[model samples]
Target: MTYLANPTRYSDMTYRRCGRSGLQLPALSLGLWHNFGGVDTFENYRAILHTAFDQGVTHLDLANNYGPPPGSAEENFGTILKKDFLPYRDELIISTKAGYTMWPGPYGDWGSKKYLVASLDQSLKRMGLEYVDIFYHHRPDPNTPLEETMAALDLIVRQGKALYVGISNYKAEETAQASAILKQLGTPCVIHQPKYSMFERWVEGGLLDTLEKEGIGCIPFSPLAQGLLTNKYLQGVPEDSRAAKPHGFLKTAMITPEKLEQIQQLNALAQERRQSLAQMALSWILKDPRVTSVLVGASRPAQLLDSLECLKNTNFSAEELEKIETILK
Candidate 1:
């Protein structure tokens, strides 16, 4: 079947500028962290991608270590890009990251010029991209000098392997240092990806302030707190849910009684807002002016479509915010 994009795709969704960079990203960018691997159904993810773009989700995020076997997400994304998204390439913001163990031996992992450069080359080949819209160092490496990793990012940009550079999972202090180095290198760290949600508020302590000060846009991952913020577990864990899965990051044990209560309270609030628990959760993150985007993962096209509804109502009253804070605490 031919894959013609929605003509009015830009009508409903919103785009925010990434830091001080000329680039802007969709409020809800799709993340290929799970369920787009070689082990998953290709049609399923392809359909999700289609639905995402149709709703103005122009940014697609990926990591070199996304798949269970590693590198398969990029390969699958490559196939879909060639098949359905070749023409719409100019309208998309494609980004990927490195800085994890990809292969055997020391050179295959961490933040080094050799590892980052080689990993990105492999990533480009897998995605069939000449250059990604943004390339990120997936995490901070305590063992490696920060300058080396930042320099590697600058080098990739100079070589035209990436249009912009970013850092992920880095703390506030680390982010400030990295951003300073990138600024000196003339690359200017444009974005910061952090694990933040109602459940995980570490970024609120300092990261968000640092990013704003450094002129780096913030895009938070795990905005739903690994599905806890969603309505799926309000009743209890479902057999088919991520928490029920033995192999995934979300474990059954993490769904304690207290967590369920918080989920239920939040669900009640979501109902008042005429939104789903997931939608409200995402909206909570988007309510922060510092957040440029929120990266979400979807297992199905319907799920992705459901997530897009968050954009419809992201505002919360002062009372609502106080209630949410009380419940979270």
Candidate 2:
């Protein structure tokens, strides 16, 4: 059955505008970085996509090299788009990115006119998309001139392949400078996808301040710290978690004794609030006004639903904040 026919199933999720723009994305958007890769079974992929849409996750984030084989995730998601999400295209905020190593050779990756344009073309073809809602430069290309990268992004927008443009993993000054260039080119940057969580506060140092100053939206990936903020590692490393994946970003060494103790302390605070550690971690990020949405990855429908439950109690009293800060220290 087509997924759009049951759109009402997701009516409960709140939608927020993308940085003063007219585009309204779901508060919690689904990302296809890990579980939806090519190596995963088709049944699990289909179920996650179906469950996400039904759970009010209208936005899906992807990149050119999301698969173990690179570009396979886009291909897999493209199949789902053709099979399930095509009819409801207008209701979805599908985004794909370029800027990482995708192909061999010098011009294969990074933010150059040659690479960005070619990457988007390949990404669109892979995803079977005529136009993606947002196109992001996956990361900053220090080697490439800012003008070249910005111009490439500008051209992508002008070519009508993307409605808006975004950047990821950019520092404060770089984001500010890129926003300036994008605006000058008549294609204003709309969002910044950064990594933020209780365990990751790098953005809080200055990146967020710059985003607020520039009127750009922020969507934080790894909001659960690659599942560390979740209960999956409470006792010890679980056999089926991201830590178990051979090439996983979250390593087993990350579960140091000190980190485990910190988690245990934070878990007590979560229990006090009558919420799971996962929900608390998500809510902690949402408390910041600059945060437009949280990008999350899920292996199952139940996990997605459980994360969304963070909305039920997002308010963090002064005392709660104090308790969390004390624990972090």
Candidate 3:
């Protein structure tokens, strides 16, 4: 069956400007980090993408090393784009990153110009895109000079491989340096992707302040803290959950008793707000105006719909905020 997008897809979602850039990203962007790989069903993956787009998710985030086997997510997304997203290309913002281990040998990873340039080329080929909307250096490389990495990003933009450039997993000092270099290169770093959630507040210490001063947008990954912030683990680990999976990042050992207790309290707070724990978690991130968007990953379309509900009630009163802080503390 041919897929048709909803006519009112843009009605409910809010778009925020990405830093000082002219680009405006959807408040909630869909990420293909988990279940869109080759091991997953094509029909299910395609359904999630279609459902997200139809509900006004214009930004789709991917990484060159997203798949278990590596590069499979981009390949699968490429096929789906050719099939369903081609007509709406201009209306969507597609992004992919590099700087992680992708292939054998020294040139395959890190922030060197050789690796970043090659990785993005491969990503574009996989996604069948002339140029990605945003291309990011996946992480900082201690060995590589910051100048070289920023120069590579600037060159990619000049070469038309990407419209905007960003950096991920970089600390405050590194971000400030990279942003300065990119600014000098005339391709100001437009966004920063970090891991931020109620359970993870590393960004609050300095990254958020640096981004605001540098004029870079902030899009937090792991906003659900690898499903720890959601209601899924409140009753203990389910056999089907990520924590139960042997090879996944969220291990069973990480789910401590104390963590579960905190989750229970937060879940109660979510219930009072008439929202799911996941929704409240996401809403808490969106409560900050500095947050350009929250990147969400899902194994199914229903999960994506639940996350979209975060948009409906983002407001939090003084008491709710204080209680949430107390629980998190």
Return the lDDT, model 1, position 49.
95
Q: Candidate 1: where are CA atoms >4 Å away?
A: none
The residue ranges of model 3 lying beyond 4 angstroms of the native Cα positions read none
- Give me the overall lDDT of model 3: 0.95
Q: Model 3 residue 75 lDDT? A: 98
- Model 3: per-residue lDDT, tens digit, 188-265? 999999999998899999999999999999999999999999989989999999999989889999999999999999
Instruction: Write the residue-wise lDDT of candidate 1 on 136-201 in tens digits.
Output: 999999899999999999999999999999999999999999999999999999999999999999
Rank by lDDT, descending? 3, 1, 2
**TM-score order of candidates, best first?**
3, 1, 2
Lowest-sum lDDT 10-residue window in model 3: 63-72
The digit string of per-residue lDDT tens for model 2 on 47-75 reads 88888888778899999999867999999
| Best by the lDDT measure | 3
Error of 1 at 180 (Å): 0.7
Native-to-model Cα distance after best TM-score fit, residue 281 in candidate 1, in Å: 0.3
Query: All models: lDDT?
Result: 0.94, 0.89, 0.95
